[model samples]
Target: GDARGAGRPTGERSGRPTGDARGAGRPGEARRDSGYRGTGNPAADRYAAKKSGAGKPRQKPSGPRAFGGERFGKDLGPVRRPKAARTSRPADELDMHNPDGVRLQKVMASAGVASRRVCEEMILDGRVEVDGTIVRELGVRVVPSEVSIHVDGMRLQLNEDLKYYVFNKPRGVISTMEDPEGRPSIGNFLKNKNKNERLFHVGRLDAETEGLLLLTNDGELTNRLTHPSYEVPKTYYVQVRGPMGPGIGAQMKEGIELEDGISKVDSFKLIDSTPGHILVEVVLHSGKNRVVRRLFDAVGHPVERLVRTQIGPIRLNDQRQGSIRVLGRQEVGHLLASVGL
Candidate 1:
């Protein structure tokens, strides 16, 4: 029924069949061909396309695209940009976050040569130089890398001093190099000074109070001991104007109120007492100004004489008055332990 065996000129049959003539007998079929047909019948072309593998399996879109309907043109939504590359920076650039750099005056003050202001004077006087060059500026940055800092041509090792001495500070001796009013200072009592390294006092002993005081050139240690959070304990021997009755102990233990607020005594003991005066030992952990004098004055008594016997775990020991002794390594360790350093 294909008409191929009749050899009716395979040209017409093999090329394209005349679908219009074939559909003439079928009126409804000719209407279907007229919708999309060109010069040749679209139904014959569609049949040929199906036979030649045009109707092969088609892949379904997946994920977000599976739900998206057909669209025209290329997708032009945002495209991610690559991250920029990082470059190295120089060491001189300040972090601005860290504040560990020591100030110029403080470095000089800690070196034991002078106060911060005095060090500036010395620097301006052409006495301070760094790495063989005279530097007269205040707050000149100096790293602890042996940058070769010197005062008046004498090479100064800012941290090499390691001096730690306890002075049985005598009354009338101000705890400084030279008093502004020309009064004799603690430096007057010190003999055989080392010119290479400087020395400075840790804390002050008033001009009229005789007690134990430590001196050092270590700035870091000085900062730590003086830091309020440390709460370093100080023991004082007080000579008051009246006999310390049992009520005195209770009042001291309860904390006495001063003008500033309550002044606390960690512990107190009545060492010896007379009807006219009492010798009491008080232990406290405050760095408030003139605390012992104020506490006694609060309790209807006055301190006739006060002497500091201990700082933290360091005691004056048998070191006599007017004598200076360096704190031993073990003693320094005990001091660190007292403040939980």
Candidate 2:
């Protein structure tokens, strides 16, 4: 049986020595735990540990000087418990009920998202949020048009009164909703639409020049879209009577002096060319009367045809002439965000 430090008591301790008592004796040797020298046989190990006065709890040894040292007893410090994980309050626990507002499910149904029963289930499954907070309670209520809502991560427009549409105004159709002379106007195209609700054309497309025009009942949106401060770009596909001269794009982009102001294209790209004509795309933020026509006239190339293709983030891609199309929910969201609405 081993006989090293056998008489040492369990509770007693001292400064770290060159080697622990369980290790084989050699004054200058590094300390090793009992496991390093232990025999594979359990019975033999037990007998040896019994003789070596081990298998009893001893004082925790100071860690290496590298851990926290300049002193003999300094260690890595006490094992600490981590901060408690933050937990959100359960949906049902928060006060979501609004006695005066419409029920959440009903609002969802009214917005054409789903039927009341399905919307309720969706809420209970945590698929609905009101102003960024998930709502699971069936009794929650919100003013239909006052709060921002989302289902399955897509924003839902709750205001039924507000409507938006993109109209493909064919050439020669007046941009106004109605004209006294009974010429082809926007009103003629909307005769079959809901008659009671008033709609406003967002911006004008002159009687002879037409393409994409926005129509909506959202008055504030209309005002901002027309306001020059927003500088919303409009893209046009233009055809001009040209011998296709060089530097026209650069000169137009640099700015063309007119009676109103120095007008310029944000971008000018040559699309196609032939012996007698040039077709190009021009983007600019100017909302002046007959701006495109005058810009081309200044450059000595008369505008043969002009068709606006885009406004802000809205595109008039392949829409049939004189057809009216409703804006999708995401499209409306993007439109609203474009003007900081």
Q: Compare the candidates by TM-score and give the number of the best one.
A: 2
Candidate 1 per-residue lDDT over residues 273-328, each given as its tens digit: 78798888889888888888888888878878888899987898778877788776
Q: In angstroms, how far off is 132's CA in candidate 1? A: 38
Question: 43-114 in candidate 2: lDDT tens per residue?
Answer: 675578667656455566564433443334337455443333435455345555567888899988877777
Model 2: runs farther than 4 Å from truth?
Answer: 1-141, 149-156
Please report the TM-score between candidate 1 and the true structure. Answer: 0.51
lDDT of every predicted structure (CA atoms): 0.68, 0.79
**Clash totals in order:** 0, 0
Model 2 RMSD, rounded to 1 decimal = 11.9
Kindly give the stretch of ten consecutive residues in candidate 2 with the minimal lDDT sum. Answer: 11-20
Count residue pairs with overlapping backbones in model 2. 0
Task: Specify the poorest-scoring 10-residue window by lDDT in model 1.
Answer: 89-98
TM-scores for every candidate against the unseen true structure: 0.51, 0.63
